[model samples]
Target chain A: MFGEYSLSELASIFAMQGFSGLILFSVFVLMALGLAIIYGQMGVINMAHGEFMILGAYVTYLVSRAFGELPHALFNVYFPVAMVAAFLVAGALGAFVEWALIRRLYRRPLDTLLATWGLSLILQQLYRTIFGAREVGVTMPEWMMGSLKLSDTIEVPINGILVMGIAVAISIAVGVMMHRSSWGRQVRAVVQNRTMAGAVGIDTERTDRLTFAVGCGIAGVAGSAFTMIGSTGPSSGQLYIVDTFLVVVFGGAASLLGTIASAFTISQAQSILEFFLSGSMAKVLTLLTVVGILMLRPQGLFALKLRK
Target chain B: MLKIANLRSGYGASEVLHGLDLELAPGEIVAVMGRNGMGKSTLMKTLMGIIPAMGGEMSVAQTPLNGLKSHKRVAAGVAYVPQGRMIFSALTVQENIETGLTVTGRREAPQDLYSMFPVLWEMRGRRGGNLSGGQQQQLAIARALASDPKTLLLDEPTEGIQPSIIKDMARTLKQLRDARGLSILVSEQVLSFALDVADRIVVIDNGRFVHEAQRADVDAAAVERFLSV
Candidate 1:
């Protein structure tokens, strides 16, 4: 594949592919970060994770339409406002789902998977009924419409930069929140030993609820970012859900740094391979490599070491 | 002060602690001693609200803890150090101690806990999993103390500790009582350790207290016989 291209052309291909891979990395990190917390810490298999992301996308779309009618000066600010609204709306729904559906299934991991799968179906159909069956694209604020030309062959979309920025910011925020915040302490404690965490006065139930909500809230933010690259369809989250889980599992589910590393590796590998091979072939090769690595190191890249 | 009345708790359908009543005066150390499956741990768990009361009442500093969840019971002033010292393996010693402080919504860990368990202070930055068994036990006690709890419940404090450390643990329990004016309820299997630390001793057999006596009046031969089977 490289034989036909000149050295400069190859350089441009690598740079451009790497940049696109970064945008893909942002989406994977945002989605997988939440799944890492939820599936990793709580052991709750949230099959409806994609639906939660889609909810955020639809919410962002609606917010954009609403902001479109506002004064011309306010239009530029709609994206940030929509992002916040997406977080709260999705978080509120997540909180409700946790209390009503998930709290009962804490001990039943398999049941959570089945129940949440049902929840995803319901959420998808609801989105279809409400937002219509067709996919909707949010109108980009004018500032996000342009591309930065690094070279004649290497052009990067402004929105891609914005998406990557959001990913980095949220990742840092999550890292700090999980390490420094009191709730993070509680969450970690609860994950290690729920009964002991309770004895120490950390409300395990409340911790579980908040952890799940925060996970969903992150997916919502990812949804806000998702609008820039993909249209908001009822089933759009389905396209990314498998990749998100792959990132989480391949990274070592409980390790934040591992998740980031895996997301980057997978995204970069897929994009670069896609440039050389068919898109499906790229996905297959990427997955095969991950599976091969997992077979060798089943615990993942940076699994937490605990004595049995 | 800590009080448990007609306490009955069990796993699922099988009752473990059957109508057991106990009380601890402020600054008192009481040991509930029994062999395995005699409900000593059950009594301790029931007191800590880790096990739901089948039928009974528990209170710490006069706050009724019957319907309260385990965490709420801690906030109401009862703390627990379970068997094997259930430390948050991933958390630093300081963070583990701070877990108790969260009950009172206090962000800072108590400085005195470091003094009480000086080893924990020395290894405050180390993860809980790195501590020695004795160090982890002391850390567990220190963690429970961070909330400034009125009462502490310990289940099998000597479970995995060496004989030398067991003596030190007893001494520390006495020190904790003298310093904090906190009542302690410790469940144990070893009579010598109980005799060494407890002001009062009660033997549980078949989910009920079969023998009760002040530490001075405890019959070593009789208690040993009950434990033999």
Candidate 2:
């Protein structure tokens, strides 16, 4: 595949594609982090998880548009404010959904999948009615626009680096919160044994609601970061849903480290393969490989051995 | 500290607890002995609000507990160590204990719980799943105590536990009753273990208390009559 290209050209192509893979990995990690928390902890298959991300993207777009009429100085800080807004708005809606719908369907996982898929269709249509069917793009802050020249042929986009950094920071924060915090202990307890957790005084229902909201909130943040890389539309989130689910399931559902590792592997393989083959073919091959591996080892890369 | 009157509950259409009445005073240990499929667990779960009462009046420390949720029941001073221990197996011993504290709005487990269950302290870093059955039972009890509950509900604590630790468990219950003045309602299949630890014994059959006796008056043959199939 590389015979037609010079040695330096091949090196540069590999470097650029690797960087692209990192960006893809960042998006996958962000999306899968939320899915893993919701599906992994609470056993809810949220098909509308993609809609939640799109909601975040829409929130970011609205925040940028609102800031357009304000002072130029405020434009530089709008992104951070938008990220927070995205998280809060998406999280609040998530809590509402949990209370109104997910709570009733918890004992029925397949029903939740169907219901949330229906919810996704509704949300997508709602977005179209509200924000219009046209694709929207956010104007990036000046600081996020340029690329850094690592060598003569190798240049890394500043926005890609920022997204990767955000993914790393958020992953660590979530890891610490889930493992070290007192609330995390309660969440784990509820996950392990709901009746016992309640018997010991933990508010199991409230924990479920909060966990679902946090997962959606993180998805919102991912959507906000996504605008730096791609355009936002009513169904833009659906584009990544399949890939994100692949990342999460290809990892052990409940393992955070596994999510990151699987995301990296999937993204890198797709990116490198895309360089030699068409994009769709690369994706098909990568997914086929994952499906084959999963067939052999159904538990994925990291399975937690829990008592029945 | 705990009372249930005319309580009725069951799984769906089949009722398990049929108009049961029970009471526990402060610093008292009441052992509920029953055969398999009787209402021993049902009564405990009903009191803890894990199983909703079909018809009943329940209270802890004079507060109405009828409509309260399970956590609210715990907040109203009830804690449960369910059958099978039900510890968070993937969590470390410390984390499992910490859950009790977090639920009750406490920042940490009581300092003395560690000394009381020395094995839990020794294996604080180990996962709950890795502990022996006896150790897991101890951990469950320790977790219940972490909430500083006024009433403790234990269902079959010694079912799979070793004999040596059963003695320790009895001693611990006696100490909790005598020293801390904690009210306890325990369900047990073993007559000897119950006799050793209980201040009062109640025999349940077909979801109703068929016999009751003070600790000194408990007849082994009478209790056995209720326990046998």
Candidate 3:
């Protein structure tokens, strides 16, 4: 196969594949950011994060179905409306989970991990029971369906770029909220030191609920965006959870820079490996690499300097 | 400015503060001197609403504070600089200070607070965890001051700190008490520090306020009987 291709042809093939890797990396970052907030910031391992994404995807699916029943002129403008609805639906469910369960498990990291895992199972079952076990395909509008060509043979999917843009935008917005807003301060206070935060009059419970919800809501948005690249189903979140967790843990908990760096590194590694090895082998190699890194940097790439 | 009457509180099944009665008049520095596990910290927690008051009435600035959450108490003008100075290890000194502003909804940090602790202002960008124990304690006190509470609670402020920093903290507290007329309720194991700074002293052992006296009246013998083995 290599003998038939010139150097320029190989370079172009790698470049095109790398562009696709960047898009996948963007999605992985979005999915992990939410997990980072809930699990890394609050130490609440939200195993149900993927389910929250699925919820968002399903909301987008419903919106699309509703738009399909409308006139062609009306359907075009309804895209923004569907996006908003999907975000709200996911956020609301995230808030509900926080209020009902997350609030009760403060300072219980292992328990939270187990509890959220159970929540993920329940959510998957709920989705399957309601929407059936078959994958649900969300139809995109005519304008969002094709690819954009940059050169003689350089083509990029428009949906991939849109998803990547949304991811970057969401990441920036969440970063600002964490560092700049009053809510962010409270969340940081809670994450840094709960007892002190409480003494200073921060409603740690309320902050925990809001933070967890925000994290889940963002995951939902990622799921909604992902419908363009992958199938949407009750179990859609399961496909992303491993990659999402890998990115979050690899980056280091509670650090946005870590998440971004990890996503970029993992995406490029997986994409490049996919070119040379089988998909399963590429994934295995990525996992082994992450595990090795963790073994060395137990505090992660960016450690939260906790006083003994 | 702050009053607690028959306030009862506990951790799980063990009652730490039982029917405690305490008061801090505006502009006054009141210290609670007791040994470890004597409910001094618990009384402070109950007043700040960190621990739920099990029974009896509690009031801050004459308003009922029972059933109100900790943050509500903060909004109602109560701030606590807890024992061990629980500063956010990952956050910078400036960010740690900003945590106090969350309760105020202010668009900017109060510049007056920086003037009070110039050291914190100098090291504003330094991580809280990187600071020395003395610096962290200063950051904790400064954070409470940022909230600009009517009543300030300091639990073991001078504990595990250098003597020079302790003197600095005492002076700062005196200035804050005089300039702002901020009522203070400090819990301390160091009786000498309390004797020098406090206007009145309250003594507790096990789970109750066993004695209350003016600072001038609290003799070394009396404090020794309460705090020492």
Candidate 4:
């Protein structure tokens, strides 16, 4: 494939495709962060996680429409407000679901998987009934429109840059919470030993609920950021669910840095290959490579060093 | 203060503890001596609320502990160290101690805890798993005391430790009681350890206390008869 192109042409192709890969990486990180907490930390497989993301997207869609009717000066700030709303709504729903559904299924991974799969179906139909089946796009402010000219070979969209910024900020925030904060220590303690954590006066049950809620809330933020690059639809979350799981599982659980690393690797491989191969073919090849490696190392790229 | 009357608890369908009654005054050390599977651990776990009380009433200073969650029990000034030393192995020594302060909604391990177990102070930055069994035991006690609990429950504190460390631990227990005025309920198969530390000794068999005596009045041969296999 490289035989037909000049060196400069190949360089530009790589640079442009790499930028697109960064955008995909942002979305993957956002989607997978929540999974890392739920599946990684809590050992609960939240199959409806993608639906939570879509819930955030729908919330953003509504917020954008509402902002459209408001004063023109307010439009520039609507995205932030929508992101916050998405986090709260999704987190609240997650807490409720933990109480209603997931709590009963703890330590039963297969049950949580099946239960959450059913939950995903219910959420999809709920979204379909309320928002209709048709996909909808958010109205972007003029300031978020246009592209940044970075040399002659690259002109990146401003929204893509904004989404990347949001992803980075959230990643940093999560890392800080998991490492530096006292509550984070309790979360880690519970994840390590539930009975011991309770023995030490840490409310293990409440910790589990908050951790689940926070994970779902992160997914909502992911969905909100996702609106910049993709349209909102009831089934759109389903499109990314498999890919998000791939990023998370391949990255390994209980390690935030691992998720981000795997997302970057997978996104870059797919985007660059998609430029040369068909999109589906690119996806197939990337997945094949990951599967082959995973077969040899079932623990993924980073295994947690927890006590046995 | 700690009291239990007609306590019944067990694992699943087989009831291990059958109507056991016990009490401990403030700053007192009570050792429940028994053979393996004699309900010593069950009594401790039930007291801490780790296992449900099938039929019983337990109180710490007259505050009932039944139906309260384990964390709440800890918040109400009860701390537990289970058999095999159930330390949070992945956490640093300091973090493990800090976990005890969780009920108080505080994060810092008290300075006195460092002085109480200076080995733990030296190993504060190391993971609990990295410590020797004796050090981990000390860390476990530190974690328990970090909450400044009114009562402590320890299961097999001498299990899987060298005899020298066990002696040191007995000394530690006595010092802890005199310093903090804490009530301690320890289950042990090691009679010597019990004789060294406990103010009172009870021989438990089949989930009930069969023989009881003050530390000063305890007949070693009689207690040994109940403990022998």
User: DockQ-based ranking, best first?
Assistant: 1, 2, 4, 3
**Per-residue alpha-carbon lDDT of model 3 for B58-121, expressed as tens digits?**
7778888898888888888888988888888778899888888767877566888889888889
User: Model 1: per-residue lDDT, tens digit, A1-308?
Assistant: 89999999999999999999999999999999989999988999899999999998999999999989999889899999989998998899999999999999999999999999999999999999998999999999899988999999999999999999999999999999999999988999999999999999988989999999999999999999999989988888889999999999999978999999999999999999999999999999999999999999998898867555
Measured over the true interface residues after superposition, the C-alpha RMSD of each candidate is 1.2, 1.6, 1.9, 1.8
Estimate the TM-score for candidate 3.
0.93
- DockQ value of candidate 3: 0.62
Chain B TM-score for each model?
Answer: 0.97, 0.98, 0.97, 0.98
State the lDDT of candidate 2 residue by residue for A63-93, as single tens digits. 9999988999999889999999999999999
Which parts of model 1 have CA positions greater than 4 angstroms off?
A: none
The CAPRI classification for model 3 reads as medium
lDDT to native, each model = 0.91, 0.92, 0.86, 0.91
Evaluated with lDDT, which candidate comes out highest?
2
TM-score of chain A of each: 0.99, 0.98, 0.95, 0.97
Model 4 chain A: worst 10 consecutive residues (lDDT sum): A299-308
Candidate 2 residues lying further than 4 Å off, grouped into runs, are A306-308
CAPRI rating of model 2: medium
Point out where model 3 deviates above 4 Å. A1-5, A304-308
